[model samples]
Target: MFPNLELVKMVADIENPTLFSHDLKSADILFLDLIVSGGNINTLADFIADIPILIITSAISRWQYPEFIKNREHFALQKPISLQMFQSCIEKAIQP
Candidate 1:
C-alpha cells in the first residue's frame, strides 16, 4: 500500500500519476486508472511488475488489456464506489 508521501514517491510522480508509475521493479502494489483507451495501456504496463494492480474504472472505460498489462490479474472497480467498498478493497489488498 502507498502509505505516505515517501511511499508514493517511490512508485509514481507525486504530482502526475499519469506520467509516471513509481519504480515497478521494486514495487509491491499499484493503483492506477485506465481511463483512456489504447493511449496509455502500453506505458502503464511498462511500469507494472509482478504486483497486484488495482485499477479504478467503470464499465464504460474502453481501455483494452495491452500485452504489458495483460499478464497482471488486476482488480477493477466500477465507478461510484461506496466508501465501504473502497475501504474493503484496500484492506483486502493489504492483507496477506
Candidate 2:
C-alpha cells in the first residue's frame, strides 16, 4: 500500500485513557480500538483534533460520532478488516 509511509506502534491501556496522554501528541495517525475503550469518544476526538484517526471495531454500524462522520480525517473500519480496506482507509484519511 504505502511504501513511502512510515509506521509507528504505541500501546496504551484503554481502561485508563489518560495514562498515555502525552505520548499521543507526537502521533500523526491513530488506530483506535473502540471495543477496548468505551470512554468518551468525543473527548478523544477533541484531544486529537486535526489528526487522522482510523477506528477499528466490530460494531461499526453502532458508532454515531457526528463530528467524526463529518470530518474527512476520521475513518471507520469493521473488524476482520482486510489489508486492502485498511490501505484504502489510510489513503482516504491522508489525502489532501
Judged by lDDT, which candidate is best? 2
Q: Compared with the true structure, what per-residue lDDT tens digits does model 2 show for residues 8-94?
A: 655544555566666566667777755444455555655566454555444556445445544654567877888988888777877
Candidate 1 residue pairs in backbone clash? 11-22, 12-22
List model 1 lDDT by residue over 1-96, tens digit each.
Answer: 335313543332233435554355556656555555435444555456555545544554435645455455666566678777766776666676
* Model 2, total clashes: 0
lDDT of each: 0.53, 0.62
- lDDT for model 2, please: 0.62
Error of 1 at 63 (Å): 9.1
Prediction 1 TM-score vs. true: 0.55
Candidate 2 Cα outliers beyond 4 Å, as residue runs: 37-46, 50-58, 62-73
The CA lDDT at 59 in model 1 is 51
Tell me the alpha-carbon RMSD of every candidate: 5.4, 3.4
